[model samples]
Target: MQSMTGFGRAEHADDGLIARVEIATVNRKQADIHFSLPRELTALEADLRKLVLRFISRGRANISIHLERVSGCDDSFSVDPDRARALETAFNKISDLIGRPVALEASDFIKAPGVLTFSNSVWDVNEAEKAIHPALETSLKNLVQMRKAEGADLKTDFLKRLNTLETYSSVIGKATSNVVERQRELLHNRLREAEIEIDLNDERLLKEIALFADRCDISEETTRLASHINRFREYLDSSEPVGRSLDFLCQEINREFNTIGSKANDAGIGQSVVGAKTELEKIREQVQNIE
Candidate 1:
């Protein structure tokens, strides 16, 4: 088992370049990856996405990559000579029109829009991959480790809740066993108190009691609930992604519990069903975080 929430970061410096990668994830029904990469690395988005998907099957993940050149690297900013010349000519014309010298400092032209252009570092795809892949691998390893640790904790909680559910299911089954007989006895006593003398073996009374028994019996629901619980436990032991599967199982469990609650008729059995459903609800919430 693994959780869908974790964070990891790694940095690597090589050949006058420093690369940093950070990855964060939260629980989601499907894998959704968003990346923040420098323009030079944008073309590698597909490969990066594939790498992330290989590690994470379900989550909303945010990946960010930052790259910086070492101090000794060549300058990345340059002035556009043509634009600077045009600006200078325009300034001289303005000065002639004003009939006075319009003094402009180098700082003015340097700061002008389009005068100074930043040159993006040329990147070799192979070199960039070599530098970034290791950092990404390290980050993913840490993320998985954290997720596994959290999954262990979640597993403990889920097991406790499952035990509670099982206990309540057992109680409900026992309470339901004699509920029909008890109801029939109570009905007979009420009829005698009301002075309604009917044959104890009347065909109508027997049919009504039989119908009541059928309506109140929750054996089928309890059996299915047990099956679902066992399947849920098996899924917990699985190594593959089981979040969706466990979620579906939780729905099935809740459905069976709801049927039992509605049909059990006896107060004690109803209460037990409620308790079991409560535990199952908690398990469902935890399953949402599993992957």
Candidate 2:
């Protein structure tokens, strides 16, 4: 099992370029990949998405890539000679028209638009990709490790709650054993209180009691609930993605518990049903984070 929540980051430096990658993931019903990359590296998005998909089958994954030029590179600063010369000529003309030696500062020309520019070092796409791929691989590995650790914790929690559900189910089964006899006694007491005379061995009363017992029988539900629980445990031991499967099993379990609660009319059975339902709900919540 693996969880859908985790974070990882990695950095690599090659030649005069540095590459950093960060990966984050959160639970989702389907697989999704979002990337934040520099314009120069936009073409790598498809490859990055494919890499993430290799590790995750379902989740919302966010990947970010950052690249920077290291110091002491061959890049240099240069002045646009044409723009600078034009500015200098204009300044000379202005000084001549004023008939005074107007001072012109080199800083003024440097500040002029387009006068000075840095010559960025040419980047080879293949080299940049080579530098980024290793960092991306490391990040993904770390992410999977974190997700697996979290999954182990979630599995432990689920097992504990499953035990709780089993305990409650056992209590309900015991309480339901004499449900028919108890219902019959309640009917007799009601008749006595109403001062009505009816034969305890009347055929009509016996028939009614038999029908009531059939209506309230929960043995089938209990049997099905036990099967569902066993299937759920089997899924937990599976190595493939089991979130959707576990979610479906939770619904089945809940349905059986609901049937048992409605059919078993004893107060003790009702309380046990409530406990089982509570534990089942918690298990469902935990299952949502599994992949």
> Could you give candidate 2's per-residue lDDT for residues 187-272 as a string of tens digits?
88898899987888988778889998898888888898889889888887887899999999999999989998888877888888
lDDT of 1 by residue, 1-291 (tens): 899999999988778777799999999989999988766678888988888888999999999888766786776787888989988898899999999998878888877877886653556666677778878878998899999899889888888888898899888888887898898888889889999988878887788889999998887888898898889888888778889999999999999988888888778887788778778888888899998
Q: How does model 2 fare in lDDT?
A: 0.86
TM-score for all models, in order of appearance: 0.85, 0.82
Q: Which stretches of candidate 1 lie over 4 Å from their true place?
A: 80-126, 199-201
Task: Please report, as a residue range, the 10-residue window in candidate 2 with the lowest summed lDDT.
Answer: 117-126
